[model samples]
Target: MEIQKNLIQLGQSFKTKEEAITFCGEQLVSGGYVTPDYVPAMLERNSELSVYMGNFIAIPHGTDAAKKEVLKTGITIVQVPRGVNFGDEEAPKIATVLFGIAGVGSEHLDLIQKISIFCADVDNVVKLADATTADEIADLLNSVEV
Candidate 1:
């Protein structure tokens, strides 16, 4: 998956997970990755299962049913240094890095794996979260091994 520098947003703060997801979806939509309908699908998928990966990373993508909404394969990164709660207040799953994805065909699976492996290290996730500019995040994500 190619991480477009234009799609990356650094130092963002969201009040809610929904807001964060919405921003992610909008980024994808604006980038011509998916149709507007894909946004709601992303939210629904999140509601059904937590997209929050450990190590302060969250990968938000649409459901299988929304695959038709994909216009192209794209990835957008949103950095929230302050962190946003993806779980309930009691559980508290905070995500400092959000990866919004829209994939064509089966590319999403590989993309997810690549992202997972890259973010398995907390230091890598911190590099992304602490990114000062969009290019920094893009460079880091684009450097994903495999």
Candidate 2:
């Protein structure tokens, strides 16, 4: 599936998980990707998907009725100065967070799989955590061939 560059920019600018989810939902709504009212539910779902891997990376995502109905498929990147706890026993600081929202019936599993592979690389996640701008993050993402 073709990655939506605009969605990546929307994700990169969020400072908090709540903000990230809200912004992603808003983008889905405005872009006709999802309904606006699905934001809260999406947040609730994201809370459960939060995972903090070592090296300052957090991936919080959910594919529930609200998210699946609204998002279709998109990715959002968020940077937190102090990082957030992902509910792990270690609860490591997640300096950078990425949300991958997939809607029902969307066949972008390849893109999602590629993103997962990219995030699994410690070096790439480290670089993403340190990215200073949305464009830089987007560029990094684009550099990865899905």
Candidate 3:
């Protein structure tokens, strides 16, 4: 999925994973991509399983049950230059970029796959994490080879 300029928030710093995820959910809700209920579902999904994808990134999305709450396909990217911890004391997982998604049907799967492949390269993730502008991040993602 190509990054939307308006959906991206650059230079963010969240205290907790929950707070960061909430911000992503709010972005989706405010963008008219999903219903308000979808926010709680995102939290629930994260609780059930961490959205932390490693390499300083996290992709938070609603549970399968919350699929019905989606109004349209959308994504929100939050760049945390300082990074946010997404793990416990036993293991520390600091995420510098958060990708919140609300997709219709199976569309999000393709997006997730693309993101996974793009992010698999630690250098690419660093570029995103260090990006200072939304347009820069968008261009990076849009220009990347799947």
Higher-lDDT candidate among 2 and 3?
Answer: 3
Model 1 Cα shift for residue 76 (angstroms):
0.5
- State how far residue 82 of model 2 sits from its true place (Å): 2.4
lDDT by residue for model 3 (1-146), tens: 55678999988888889999999999999999999999999999999999999888899999999999999988888999888999987999999989999889987787678888989999999999888888888888889732
Task: Give the Cα lDDT of each candidate.
Answer: 0.90, 0.58, 0.89
As for candidate 3, its clashing pairs are none
RMSD of each: 1.1, 3.7, 1.2
Native-to-model Cα distance after best TM-score fit, residue 63 in candidate 2, in Å: 3.5
Q: Rank the candidate models, highest lDDT first.
A: 1, 3, 2
Encode model 1's per-residue lDDT on 96-141: one tens digit a residue. 9999998899877887889999999999998888879887887787
Residue 65 local lDDT, model 3? 95
| Best of the candidates, TM-score | 1
User: Where does the lowest 10-residue lDDT sum fall in candidate 1?
Assistant: 137-146
Q: Indicate whether candidate 1 or candidate 2 has the larger TM-score.
A: 1
What are the per-residue Cα lDDT tens digits for candidate 2 across 74-109? 555555555555443464455455544545454445
